[model samples]
Target: MQARKDKQVNDMVEKEKIYPLIVDESENIAYISDPETYEVIYLNQAMRETLDLALGEDYKGRYCYDLFQNRKTPCPFCTNDRITKERFYTWKHYNEKLGKYFKLRDKLVEIDGKDYRLEICVDITDSEVHNKDLERQLSAEETVVQCIHALSGNEDMDVAIHSLLEIIGGFYRAEHAFIYECNYSENTVSNTYEWHRKDLMSRKEKLQDIPMEYVAQWKEHFEEEEAVCFPKYCEEGEARLPEILQGLGVRRHMAAPIWEETSEKYGGEKKIAGFIGVDNPTKDIEQVSLLHSVAFFVSNDIYKRRMIYKLKDLSHVDALTGLGNRNSYLEKIEDLKAAHLKSLGVVFVDINGLKYANDHFGHPYGDEMIRSVAQGIRRYFPEYSYRIGGDEFIALYIDGTKEEFEERLDGLRDYAEDECICDFSMGVNFGRGNVNIEEQIGYSDSMMYVEKQVYYGSVLDGRRLQHKALARKLVRDIEAGRFEIYLQPKINLETGAMVGAEALMRREGEDGEILLPDKFISLYETEGVIQYLDCYAFEEVCKLLQEWIKSGGTPVPVSVNFSRLSLMGSRVVNRLAEIRERYEVPPELLVIEVTESVSQMEPRALKGLMEDFEKYKFVVSLDDYGYQYSNLAILINMNFVELKLDKSLVDDLKSNPKARIVVENSIDMCRRLNQVISTAEGIENEDQLNILKEFHCDVGQGYFFSEPLPREVFLEKFGGHHVF
Candidate 1:
């Protein structure tokens, strides 16, 4: 028993020596204290060094709370009750006294049959600081992603900029964010975009045209630094704030410059166009990198907006006279329809003898004359003038008195005369309120035309004089039966049989020379005499049909061309029916041909005219089908027996594949519509004829068959019958 007792004492001594040695060598802080009295029992080397204790100092009477927390009483955070002999309690804590973070492991330990608290503390200050930096970097990356999404998702510059500002302001916890545009030419800056936190009054309205000198220091700093940061606004020092910022009550701010590539006209240098900034940021005010990234995107957007505006300006303005172009005039007309005006005045001005000048002098001289006229007009009505055409200008005045408008008009006339500008025909129209602009413009145009006619008559202009003389001569010739009917035979494509004849009008000149319709038709139409010619041709056709019927010959169907103007007249169908009855000719034997120009007429009116023709038992055929305004809606609505393809389409049938497709589809479309006959005009070659035949065209008429022949020649050749 004595030997065993001695061995136990020896073992205890050895264990105690080893424990102190191991604990002293550990890097972690370790300590032991009495559980009840809170007195320090043992302290490791690390613990002594951390607490500034001497290497061999006695810690027997010192309390653990006094050494660790600097308190006289037991620490409230002590883990004596929480720790057990079998398990270690672990926790992380920041020590206020030491200004460090620690990970602590606590356990209940026994010495001499008494319980005590033993704690091992691991310093984690550096780890904690590193973690915080990682979190900040992650947050900044997320903010950048959101800003990029906002910038790319919105197309409107205003909306995109506002969204970016909102994101940035919220990210930095700023009170305000804004963008300022710098105008180097004007030596000024303006707050173009701004965002403020909720309940904050906006300062954008008051920050207009601030002198560039206010931001001189900022510009200098921007050149040297990635961004300009003011952690705190100051006065009366090297860090003095601008008066503008002082007035704005800005406490802290950061900004980045927006740069743009200047055009060659401006020396092709990179310059600061604007700046994006935040004010009174609550956190991360030193993160200038984010501001620089946002500025890059903003600069691109500003450049794009400037280019769009420049192109839009070019499109709306005339290059010659610096006035609004035709497109602008059309948009203005639409705007005027919705505008509120007490009084409205319109002036229509046309430069007379423009074509004469253009033909005699070079185009440059004519252009100069036009420019002079435009300048004179602009002098009187600068704000509301447009060069709608090469030599035409229109001016509008709103909420103006008639007297005022007349005075301006007189001034314009005097300016033109005094400046020796080109001669002008001016027409004026005025209304009280909410008048029809179209009708007013039409009336003004008519007045202008009358004045132009008078001027042309007074002057010795060849084109205008010839137009007038031809118009008068045409009226007399129609009265004297100088207009004769000619016929172009329509042949059945497969059999070469004469199925029909179209009655064309020709003028017999005084020298016994034949004048084609092209030479005089447009002139007569302009003078409103073509409708009379149409009636005369119809009556003469009726007289011939009467003769053919009396001669007891089987007369083929004869088509008569009628102008749209003549068809629009009241009771025209009835008058045509009366002529048919007087001639005692069969209604089926006469076909009335209307050109495609009638497609532009009112739908209801055109439909009514077709119905009238049907009522009179007259067959109606749409002539010049593939000409201008080839509307399928007209064909669907009208009761037409035949559709005549225009000569232009036939001329290109062999050479143009697209035209061939169009013609083939057109023929197929007509075939599906109640078996409407498709006649191809101007089939001048055998290739064209074969192509039309391949497309199963119904009738063909052109020089390939014969030119237009006089009435006597047509009867002598075809014998007023279906000639095979």
Candidate 2:
């Protein structure tokens, strides 16, 4: 048909009348062009109208494609040899500039023996809008499927969801887009993910914790199987935007509801789960409706993840103490191993005396004790703690030091002490680099056991067991009358007369041989059984005093040794009172000797016990003064009745100038405080005794007087009148 039309155009041009034939002012647009140059030679009045040309515009030399198709050259289909390829060039295509489509029919022609092309074009865009809409719907569907993959492929859900929100927001030219996870049971919606277009104000943080009641109208609209589009706020009162939307400057919004049958955790019913919402978006009802596909796939991803986490909580969290369970610790160890470790610290904590508490106080109180310890640990290390055993907890610090962990450990101990929960022993070990994580953890565990032995040590584990056995044996011996007190004479430095005797403990062994401080004292102290031994020794001293009084002789002052364990217990005063009442011994007749370590005890508690001894009229002597850990400052304030110089001071007193000066200065300091100084230990020669006498030491007791003897022999040798 276009060939015959071009033949007619050629015949008309043969007559030199083609311009008159195509010049009608009608909707059928026609233009004549020089085929080789694609230059427009003539344009009909309808073509001029279609191009929106000016009344005086000329088009004789302009490129036709540039004018109509917005191309720099001729249209590819409008070729010089087009009639040779086909009878006519007929096609329909859209024009972006005009926001419409055009259909064109073209054919080659010869006018006035010159080759030209005749083109007729018509608008066809409005008739094909539905087909374009279908293509856009398919594109959006593919995008939603790709987003699901992106969300699932990433390990971090927050990052994946945020990326998806941005993609969706960008597709619709939206200012803001976000996901709100509506927790129906909790009656709240949490803003869980968001995207803010570049240069736009973010309302992600602001639009949070919204209750459904606040968006009641929005929820009502989302029940439809399409995006709830609010193109204009409050266009109808029944579909009014919430106040929050107004505050967010959201003039238009489109949201797709995520609905699902609820899990049993949320009461198991069909409901709107959450929604993906966009604010002030580009206006297109079809494009916005397509967002429902994204909401559907993303909501399922969220639900599946929540269920996985819920199951993980059941397996990974400790039931009794609510701490991370042992399996969690193993997982943490893997994390630690995988880390590029720099100054990673591991703290091993064990609840000391937990077995004792459980056995003696019942498991209920023991459970409470464990909970108190857990609470204390959570104060500083809330996230990394693990209950790896019944009474053991492990805490990790990825970038912490041994010193910082130790300080926190001390605070935990203090808390246990104050709460009376149970004592805890902790060890800290820190290292950097890709070192063995398990090795560091084991090292920390070993250190913790060592610490545990120092405070409320358990008898069932470690080196303390031997000491515990030794203490038990000594206790059995004391019960069987196998322990005896030996008195080492103390003499007046000035008067050259015996003034007192320091009661030394002696135990009869299975070999019927004598046991001195060397045989038992160290173990007793380490095992913390010294408190019992001290009480027994004091009772024996009382018996000796009563015997001396009944024999009708003047009894000298006898000082008995007391350990750190003796001063700390609440039962100390009562035990002393009971023994005092039993022995009928006045307080002045018996002196109490406190060891060097008393300074390390809780100062207020030790002071309180010391006051009680003072009230009872007992001579309170600070034993082993100037020894390791002993504080000379105690003498300056408390006015002790005597200061027994530690064996260290006397070990080299005769030869060492420093030792001599220490003893001398200590004696002088004691005199200033109105207290007496008694020197003991390693005093085996007259030179040592003479050194003490010259220092103005008020008293002395040691092997120089005589080695300690059994109770019977001591009574025979020293209890008699004028025995000195």
Worst 10 residues of 1 by lDDT: 464-473
Given candidate 2, what's the lDDT at residue 613? 69
Residue-level error in angstroms, candidate 2, position 686: 99
Pairs of colliding residues, candidate 1: none
**Segments of candidate 2 deviating more than 4 angstroms:** 1-136, 152-159, 183-187, 210-213, 223-226, 231-233, 265-267, 286-288, 305-323, 331-376, 398-403, 410-724
Per-prediction CA RMSD (Å): 26.2, 28.0
Specify the highest-TM-score model's number.
1
lDDT of each: 0.83, 0.75
lDDT of 2: 0.75
**Shift of residue 458 alpha carbon in model 2, Å:** 15
Q: For model 1, how does the per-residue alpha-carbon lDDT over 224-329 read when each residue is reduced to its tens digit?
A: 8778877433553455556688778987878999998979977999888889989999988767788998898789877887689879888998888888999999
lDDT of model 2 at position 193: 81
In order of appearance, the predictions have TM-scores of 0.45, 0.40
Candidate 2 per-residue lDDT over residues 1-724, each given as its tens digit: 9989977765666357665555552458888788778888777777788789999897767998888788985667555565432365887767665677778677776666676787777877776787777777787877787788779888787888888888788777889888887877668887778889889766667767888788776677776556777743355644666777887677877888887885797699878878897887774545865678888888888878877887979699887778899999898888876777777777788876666656643575568667767887877777698899998999887776677767876776676555433457788787876777888899999998888766643445433433343354456568788877878887666775777888988877656788778776775676677788888888888888998888888888888988877678886876787887788887778888876666666778867877776666667778877667656566655657777788778889878998898788877877777546555565777888888878878777677766777767776877753333
